[model samples]
Target: MPIPERFLDELMARTDIVDLVSESVRLTKKGSSYWGCCPFHSEKTPSFHVVPDRQIYKCFGCGKGGGAINFVMELENLSFWDAVSVLAKRAGMTMPESFGGSPDAQKRREKMLELNRRAALAFHRWLYAPEGAHGLDYLRRRGLSPGTLTRFGLGFAPDTWDALIQEMAKQGYDKRDLLDAGLAVSNKDGRIYDRFRNRVIFPIIDVRGGVIGFGGRVMDDSTPKYLNSPDTPVYNKSRNIFALNIAKKSKAGRVILTEGYMDTIALHQAGFDNAVASLGTSLTEEHAQLLSRYFKDAILSYDGDGAGIAAAQRAIPILEKAGLKVRVLRVTGAKDPDEFIKTHGRDAFARLLDKSENQVDYRLAQLQSKFDLTDDAQKVAFLQEAAQLIAARPSAVEREIYGGHAAQMAGITSESMAQEVSRALRHRLRKEKKQQERRDLAPAAQLQPKARSLRYDNIRSARAEEGVLRLLLLDPALLSRMDDLEGQEFSSPLLGRAFDALRGQAQQGLSPNLASLAQIFTGEEMDHLAQVASQPESAANGPRALTDYISIIRGEGLRRSQEQGDDLLLAMQKKYQKSKAYMEEKP
Candidate 1:
């Protein structure tokens, strides 16, 4: 069953979209909206905009536009109803008594989480016993102290086949639970065997510290050295980090991002408390968004190999999209974070952290090392990629400075590099425009109609009126005095309707919460309104807030009537003038 609309409404009402999104993507105010590199796609430039006044987000590049519920649905890959349930639970709502999935589905999901938790504990226990001697010895040789191993919940998998299967059975967990948790594999012969064997296990924990799954590395010099658990009910590789449980507690606004669990452990143990690693996957948008939440800055401390540089490059766009200030840390004389910490010690590693470069700086250095600046043809080829990278920064000043550096490096004129950067920017914009056009051309699309669309300037006027309404509704004592709306006037039809709704609800002793009003309008309408209402109004205006509001609202009403070619606006003005004249004469 779909979650009740009223329940969903209440959820949106209680939640701040900025707070909700900021918990994933680190957002900074840009003009009237928030801009970040989109977590939904790989992009050098930030085109994702969240207009909180309207409770909607739109990525100009990906064309993914929707409200809070849509964000949860896309981010979690949940159905609309399931996403609603998540928000409802967050809002402390009981879901309107009768809605959502069957009790059986909920029970099955809970069972899967229990099974995974049990398996993680079992693996940890095995690491200490004699059966896990080889794996334990391997960890010790790698310089993992007992405290370090225990901090990450490092464990061992017995080499013997079916050990996990038998162990799970002893705990009274069914074979189905093992399969559901991705801890065991069933053969054609119908025998289940442990998926992880003779390996040192690293349990992957979510921000909540739940053991979602595990990543196992072989003790021997085996090919395909690592094995990660498949997606289960409670765990998804795309949405998890290896050490977020610890990193989230750190005071540092900077996080050291590594590629593997061991590297993360070494850094953390060496006193770089904000180290985190991806869960056996390439850095994903979800990872970027998650990190951006806790830290404003991140330093890429990956291995100093060809593969490592490639991985860092891939991660840069994702991190940028999450609105994180990124820097690449080159750990000289060391292969990885673990090696660097061992050789240089924590104090030296901290110095390296201070020397980290921004994404553009690192990219230029990394690319310049490979490209032959002496060769004119190679320089031209290099400029193509470099220009594209520089074009991604939103600030015009930053782009010009980088363009000059690129010009100097290539021994070309600054004007020439500037032209190339402009060309690249235009090409990207055109491509995005074409994609948006295609989406609009789709059969099921509801392309925005110009009339109802709120322009940037209209946003301010609409917001002023909304602020008055929200303040009045939030404080019931102010509602009774709202009769003298001296200067309060709605800017757009949506705001006018919203104000009317608020007034009616207040008169009937009903709460005029924004979330309840969201269900009554289109997503675009809600987004515009939210941005307006949540945004800070003119601070210089002072007590004129009421006066300016009435002017905007009455003007909008007259403007709408004029657009319709109606004489009602004129008649209303005449009636008002006549009433004022008669009142003066009687007095």
Candidate 2:
């Protein structure tokens, strides 16, 4: 069931759209509104605007506009109910009864959460038991303190087929609950068993302190040394970062992204509290988005091996796309952060973190590794790659700084390097421009509108109808005078559909704001509608302007119909003349 209208209104009122967005985006005050880079897409400049006066935000770059709750839903990847709950909690408001979310869904999620909590506790208990001594000793050998163990809910999954299964079953949870929580797995004969065993358990927690899932590492050398839970209804690994629950509270202004659980734990143990790792998966855009909510800068501390370098290469664009200032932490004389910290004390590691190179320099260094600069062909290849990287930098100052370094590395004059980079930059710009022109010329969208409420055959009526919709979106109260306008009257079906939705809302005495209307439209459609509303120009006289818009829409329809009639009449006249000529020939 949906939330009550009154409660939704109150929720939106309590939530400040600016505060909510500023958590992720860096907003700057401009006139009466706030502007920032669009979090939904990659752009060099700020286009996402928040108009506090209207209680709305719109990204002029990507066309995403909505209110506070809607923004939460989009940014956090939460459902409407979840977004509302987050806001309500922050606002210190109570949900009126079970108006918070669907009763069934809430109940199921609670059950799964309960099961996971119980399982995590059970694993923790087992770590100290006689059978779990091996895992406990392994933690000790890794230099993990007892306090750190408890802090992270570090435990041991017993090395038995039915250990967790029986333990959870004894706690009154059935096999179904275990499976639903991703705590146990079933085999071909329907024999349910533990999914994790003979491994030290690390609970993967969310920012809300919920044990969403678990990560387990083997006590000894094993084929699959590390294992993580599958995506469950309550836990999605793609959007989750291990240790983020604690990391977000750190005084450190930036987050250190590592490759694994042990590395993150080691960093935290060493007083570098702002450390997190992805759960047994490569870095994703969603991960970057999640990270951007906490910190402005991210120092990726992936291992210094080939795979680690490659991973960093892939992560740069994603992190940049998510609008995080990225730097790469390359460890020397050690395999990973854990080993590096262990070899050199916390002070040394901290110094290395402070001295970490930006991703551009890191990649250029990596590219330099591939070439023998003494060889002519290899040096040429090295310089070209360096030029491409240097050309992509938007700042001429940065280009010169990095260009000088590249020139020094290539043993060439800085002036020659500058010319090369500029040439590459111009060539790249031309290529991108041509590509944009091709894309603009092609109607590349695959969504074929099946109804007139989408698009239409007649261009003139579509344009006029779009104007009417644009007008209605800007001023919902204008819908009162639109009683005479049928949705079918608009030439473009999408405009008509939007008009009908607006009229319906006005009839119901509801506010047809972007957030509410978003409930009726898909994200894409909502963005399009919001784009229409974001247009600044409007009429001073409301009713007169609406009447004019309606007249234009209706007149275009009539004009197209008359044009069709003329075309039909011309066809008939030509047929009649041909018949007359045939008759004369017969005579």
Candidate 3:
């Protein structure tokens, strides 16, 4: 059974939306609503708004809007019920005995987590067993002490199929559970086997200390050297980083972002506990936001290779957008941190980290390497590119400082470099203004759902539907005015479903707010509904406007039915004509 609607209503009533959101976002009052930068997506100017009266928050920039429950769900990356439970706890309310959302889904998530834990433990035990000698030797050779291995819960998968499969079976988990947990793989002909074999295992634990997934590295030269868990019910590789569970607790103020699990583990073993790595993927904006939560600064300690350089170049803007001070660690004399520390000692690596270059200088140096400054034309080209880069700096002061550096590198005057940067900035601003103008010209396009999957097929009917929803949500007393309308009449199925849900709540004498509808609506649906609610709807003219909206919706619905009927009739007539022609020819 799901939690009662009354319980959710009470929970939301006790939890203030502003108080919940203000903890993560720095909100300042502007008129009746509070505004702040959206934490869900990075932004410079504040576009996220919180309306205390409505008990909802919306980001005009990202189109993410919902009540308190949605805020917690998006900010913490939690499921709906989990988010509700968090608010319930904060409000000092006891949860109903029944689960909030789908019991089956919740059960499966818990089961997957348990299976992952059991698998992690089994792998750890196998590391010390005779079957894992080779894997153990590999880690030991990499300078991982037993204590460090234990600290990270590092393990080994034996060099045989069905080893983990058999172990999990004994632990009361079936092959299906193992597969769901990403601990086993299924091949053609219905054969099931372990996913990791003859490899060193790294358990990817969440910040909450749950074993969500695993990463394994082969002990020999293999075609695919590293293997990670596929996205499961409990794990998304893009949203998680290796060793962040421990790294978040480090006293060090900055995080050393590495490229692989081995590099992260090596850094941790060398006493830099604040190191983390992306899980077999390039650093993503989501990863940058996750890093920003714990640290004010991020040092990109990628491998000193072409791929590493390119990755750092791509990550600089993303990290900066997330409001983190970014630096690049130039690992000299070695290809990666693991090898660098092994060859030059930890002290030298620490010194290198201390002297890490800011992203501006690093990017400038990278640009300089692409051209021959001795050639006058190439020198001019280099300066042009450098000006564009420097112009992208958010601060005028930063642009000026970096412009001087670029001028020195190209042997040009600082004043000339500043002028070039100013021109580039003007060009960028004009491009942005033109794009904004295009968006303004198509105001209806801006009103469309941000997710393409939820687009409106009938703009005319959808506009009326939006008006009806906005009025009903803003004024629950207007529910009586919607007696002539039905949710199924709306042009968009998503909007129809929302209308039905909200109408049902209002009929039952419950407040038809986003919080009340959150349990029934998915996050995306809630976001769209919030967008509808955020639209301009005049309360003073609510009754008249609602009546007009309702009439328009019904009229549009009737017109659509007529059009569809005409099309069907035409199709039937064409078929009859063809059949008649065939009959005449046969006669």
Pick by TM-score: 1 or 3, better one: 3
The clash count of every prediction, one per candidate, is 21, 5, 0
| lDDT-better candidate, 1 vs 3 | 3
Local distance difference test scores for all models:
0.73, 0.79, 0.85
The better candidate by lDDT, 1 or 2, is: 2
Displacement of the residue 432 alpha carbon in candidate 2, Å: 2.4
Each model's Cα RMSD? 8.3, 8.3, 9.7
Please write out the lDDT profile of model 3 over residues 1-587, one tens digit for every residue: 66787788788779889888876676889888898878888765788888887788888888899999898888767777777777888999986745536556656887898888888999999999998888899999988999999999999998899998888888888888888888889989889999998889999998879999999999888858999999997899988888888998999999999988888989999999999999889988888877776787999998778898999999999998887899999887888888989999999999999999999999999999999999999999999999999998889999999999999999989999999999999999999999999989999887689888899988888999988877778888887656546777789998888888778778877777787677778888888888787766788888777766766676666666666788755654554345344434431
| TM-scores of all predicted structures | 0.69, 0.86, 0.81
Candidate 2 stretches greater than 4 Å from native: 1-7, 42-44, 60-69, 79-103, 438-453, 456-477, 560-587
Per-residue C-alpha lDDT of model 1 across residues 437-534, encoded as one tens digit per residue: 99778633232222345442355455556667656544544554344343323555666676776666556665555445534555556545544444
Ranking according to lDDT, highest score first: 3, 2, 1
RMSD of 1: 8.3
- Residue 194 of model 1, lDDT score: 84
